[model samples]
Target: MSGSRGIVGEKWSQKILWICAIGSAISLYLVGVERQTQNRFQKMADDLDDIDYSEKSGGDGT
Candidate 1:
């Protein structure tokens, strides 16, 4: 509670900035188009969960 106008604490402000920067970098990397290590999560834009993992772990390996 630095100010009534909603100024964050100094330490918290730096932490928040760093988190935002990291988040942005990750977002950029995901759609960066380099594609060295493809994001498997984004591979399934249709479904939130990957069905293959479920089949392998839950279903018999057939």
Candidate 2:
């Protein structure tokens, strides 16, 4: 019946919407994680730069 077909179509639409939402969430999470990782590494590099490496490397011969 036409009504039954409409019900089936509605279910499929809901499933597709759920899939898209989940995919978007995962994408956003991955992007955020990547940005955090980059920031962490940048902070570490800044911390290293703040140290006096010249005094410690004097005996290393360059």
TM-score of each: 0.40, 0.75
Supply the TM-score for candidate 1.
0.40
The regions of model 2 sitting more than 4 angstroms off are 52-62
Q: Model 2 has how many clashing residue pairs?
A: 0
Across 1-62, the per-residue lDDT of candidate 1 in tens digits comes to 44743545666888999999999999898777656435544666434354666576795434
- Over the stretch 2-62, how does candidate 2's per-residue lDDT look in tens digits? 9999999999999999999999999999999999999999999976765547556664423
Give RMSD to native, each candidate: 12.6, 4.7
Query: Over all chains combined, what TM-score does candidate 2 have?
Result: 0.75
